[model samples]
Target: MRMYISPRAPKEVLDYAQAEANDSGRHANHAEGSCFPLSWNLPPGADLGEYEWVLNGFDTKDLPSINLVPVRRDEPWETIDAHLNRFGAEYLLGIMPTLWQLEVRFHAALRRSGIPVMMVPPINLASVPSLFAQFPIHTVLTPLRYLPELRTLLPSRDPHYMTILGPSDAPIECSPGGKVSQEVHLVPGMVALFQCETLAARPTTGFHPSDRFIWEWENDRLYVTDPAARFTRLMLPRHYTMREETCDCGRTLTLTEAV
Candidate 1:
């Protein structure tokens, strides 16, 4: 029988599995919190029993509306051309760690062939113009951590392609060039923030939250605070500043590790 193990699986089951795995030296490989980035947890010939551990979705219904699908390997260029032409895509958005090794090279080749390429970092947006000998992207959307690197890469002109900084669900501020803002807003309620803080699901077993953190940014430093709630052990960078701020969006709480 196939058993689905969500992050919300029974404590006993999770504990038992963890204990057994620890004793057996069979812990999941590349495991990130409740999820595994890859499926290489088991040995070459080991069986994982009938139980299927699903860290995210049970199936397609739980996935996002944005399609981040793989391209046909035999004719990837043709595939990209077809998709962009058919869908009328302005410029292709390339999320890194592509499905195939050749995907990145093909994308670079396409850029050389004069197609626009908007790469999400740590693919290095700084090298876009230098590598491709073309104009910089119209806009760059990156996590706050990468803003420092971006500052060194901004073109001389003011408002040289907008830069969006923040987490996925948070309300990102668009800077004209490379000026980092002091504070940013969340979408009021979103799963990305809850997941980041390792906030558990409500009684109904849903990950949605009515509360979220407002991030304060400065000098390439990030501090997040959500006073109404406390954080779990899984949050990154550990202890926080715990400052408070009043805003039209919502209450602001600060979190970050000691410098």
Candidate 2:
């Protein structure tokens, strides 16, 4: 069986999902296939069955609208180039680990608009500088732990932007000539969305929650309830502490530490 989880309180998430479902003209129920109504909620400990599929965030209906290009780390440059040229790709998106393994010539080909997706511990800290020097990446997604190192590596005069991966209580140091923002990575067991774009307008040094999701702190852990999430509640897999102070960005988004 396939289950579709929708937020109960935030009407916008449900409304958006329903709109997409309606636009696609798919009418599958909770017990049926992938298409499900916004009113459906997953009961506590609901039996998802042995091989059930759960759809959330972007549903099957949203697939047609998204243009995704898949590239393998081992794929030859000629093959990747063919796909890029065939699709008329404007930019390349890849994980930091994969980008580092790719040939330098490949980096040069897509350096114009390549955006590297980074994660904590997954990305090799030592190779970052070489990647930056070889590929002129203007945008990056990384975690708070690497911010200081990244700040030191970035060119003083170049414009850069970053989207932080998770919560942190440590002060967010500014980049020499770049902007920093925050975002919650929707992992397998959890989903979260923060105001990443709004925070980009100014520099901030603490963690904050966006109005788009409900934030809860309990037992030294942070729980996020995203209105657009497929799961009811997602507990972040880290210890956290909430601080009720107004940030320099003029918003009381609160501060939290992810340890």
| Candidate with maximal lDDT | 2
The collision pairs in model 1 are: 224-254, 224-255, 225-253, 225-254, 226-253
The lDDT of model 1 is: 0.31
For model 2, residues 21-58, the per-residue Cα lDDT tens digits are 46757432222222222333444665544122222222
Residues 1-259, model 1: lDDT tens digits: 2122133434554455445445756322211222212222323454445222222211233234222322122222332343345335344434332221333544543564466655654555656445323543333323345555555655452212212212322333333322222221121001222211111111111111213332333332332332222211112222223334432234243232233
The backbone clash count of each candidate, in order, is: 5, 0
The C-alpha local distance difference test score for the whole of candidate 2 amounts to 0.41
| lDDT at residue 124 of model 2 (Cα atoms) | 61
Candidate 2: worst 10 consecutive residues by lDDT?
Answer: 66-75
Model 1 weakest lDDT span, ten residues long:
197-206
Clashing pairs in 2: none
lDDT of 2 at 65: 29
